[model samples]
Target: MILKTYRWSFVVTAVGLVLAALYGLSAHLGIFQAIALVLILSVLEISLSFDNAVVNATILERMSDFWRKIFLSVGIIIAVFGMRLIFPIVLVSVTAGLGPIEVVQLALKGGNPEDPGTYGYELNQAHPTIAAFGGMFLLMLFLNFIFGEKEHHWLGPVERALEKVGKLEYVQVIVAGAVLLVVAETFATDHGRTVLASGLAGVVTYLLVNGLGELFNVEEHLDHGEHPEGAEAEASGSEGRKGPTGAAKATGKAAFFLFLYLEVLDASFSFDGVIGAFAITSDPVIIAIGLGVGAMYIRSMTVHLVEEGTLAQYPYLENGALWAIGALATILLLSIEIHIPEVVTGLIGLAFIVASLISSIRYNRAHPEAAHVETEATAQAG
Candidate 1:
């Protein structure tokens, strides 16, 4: 099972290790130290993103095989190169008015104590904007998950109450917008406008991506007989309607949007990881190698969960992840006012995941019939 599921992950990790060693040798660092740094970074990224893996699996299960492969393959490339390396450089270059090469050189040279024109300093200066964007995006995700109607409830009263409130149209967006305004006005004094603008942009991006995903979700509509008459006839006549060909044809559009959503979600999750890496090392290349390895492991873990039917077995796993996301979002917004350790963030998410696991186990024990039904359904779906 390990070889079948994580072969790609192992291969990528080996390559990452080799590249890390080469990078260290070029920098005149000892082999052991370089290897150790990469290991530490990989651990840090994994710790910070375990909940991310669960959440990713929840979405991956709904995707087609083709898209899942694309997510694991192409998605890893974007997560590593795009977020880990290119994003910070682009942010620094844009905000600091420095060329891309200059930004990269600064990243490699590390921060200068006397001079303020350093990559770390520039990135720090842009932290508020980054926080605003990532925090708001995550806030919307959390609110939508918690507020939407759910059949199973881990935190019964609280979840049910939120669902009731969620009945109000656009309640999630309204609450999220209000929270953004309050955070910007109260905490982000120096960069309040920038924070507000970035936060709004984040909200807009989330809405657009989510709306497009729904719009292109032809499979769900077709399966439910919600398509127009002509389309329904075409769908019904196809091989006794085992599946909708329209859905297959339109899968590309849906997959494209889903891919975009996953990429954005990964980017939001990386904001803290990228920022936290500066605390360990100022070298962007090392950070990229280390975090990139961790990200690959995450992608592998996501696929593993989907294939193993982990979420279907433990129905509350997704709920736990969303709870962790809500907490992380809150922390991100609060970080504008105070310094929150990465350890604290990781621990909080782990706590939720653990709690959810326990809850799921208890639920399964209490309702074996439901559990069996879910397992059979999952098997058939797979």
Candidate 2:
């Protein structure tokens, strides 16, 4: 049944894997090596992005069908072509002071370990800026979420602490700014200027994108379809709300900004995937095709989670995903000083997700009545 919903994703996966194999053959990496590279990178992308899909679904559920169509169509194209392919090439060109053709030549030198112009090494050289930007953008997201007023508290004590602190204006910004400042002053000294600028750019970008989204939100009280009845109203209580929300007008400037916000959010998530792909192979073609395939699945998963009312059913799932984002954000920042294995990153996020899934199961079993009520509420909201 789940497979039926993901029929398109499967189709994409099949086509993508085939393309990966073909690219491998043409590159002379052997069909087996190419397939292996693609598969490893696919698993890498998928594992890192489970939290991303859940986060996206929360926003996607509130979007109108028209905009959702835009997301499902144009959104994937940007994810595949822009982030997976163009962005990496552009990054190398600009940062390495090499022309686009030279970058391509270096990328094509996949197995030449001795080449100083190796795509992976140049990207690694650029990591401080990349990590700074991605880290701060994602950290803002995590801060907004953790500091937001919510009816549910998965980690009671920790969340309660955040709730109290969130009442203060701009606490999230202050905290994020302080962290950036300290990191810039300390571990990132080598690229202090660049890191500081990139980190601030990230913060400012979040404020503009998310602030514009809230500024023009037409349906301030509209919850994403998965929200339980009275949850927002109860949380709203009076003139109060924080954190990024999906509910907005379907057309005009509101939809455009909302779409932009999602695109930015998508790019932030892709940073890790793009950088991490270097760990496997320096073949730009293989990385692009494999990660592109993985990205398609995430897009499809977002739609499935929304339509199936999965978030409403597993209430803490969102919390778990956010926790993963928080971890990712921190890891990205810390990665400047030390190397973190991709396996470790995947494991940390997966652990949170599994724990939350277990908690949600227990929650449903313990509160069978609440489950029925929420199910009905979700149907009505739809």
Among these predictions, the greatest TM-score belongs to 1
TM-score for every candidate vs. truth?
Answer: 0.92, 0.90
What digit string (tens of lDDT, one per residue) describes model 1 on residues 228-317? 233554556532222211222224676688789989999999999988887887778888999999999999999889877888889898
lDDT of the structure predicted as candidate 1: 0.84
Listing every candidate in turn, what is its Cα RMSD in Å to the true structure after a full C-alpha superposition? 3.7, 4.6
Q: Summarize candidate 2's per-residue lDDT along 3-111 as a digit string, tens digits.
A: 8657767887888889887887887889988888888888889998888999988777656667767887798889888988888878888889999999888777753
Q: Which runs in model 2 stand beyond 4 Å of their true positions?
A: 1-4, 111-115, 219-251
Instruction: Return the clash pairs for model 1, or none.
Output: none
Clashes of each: 0, 0
TM-score of 1: 0.92
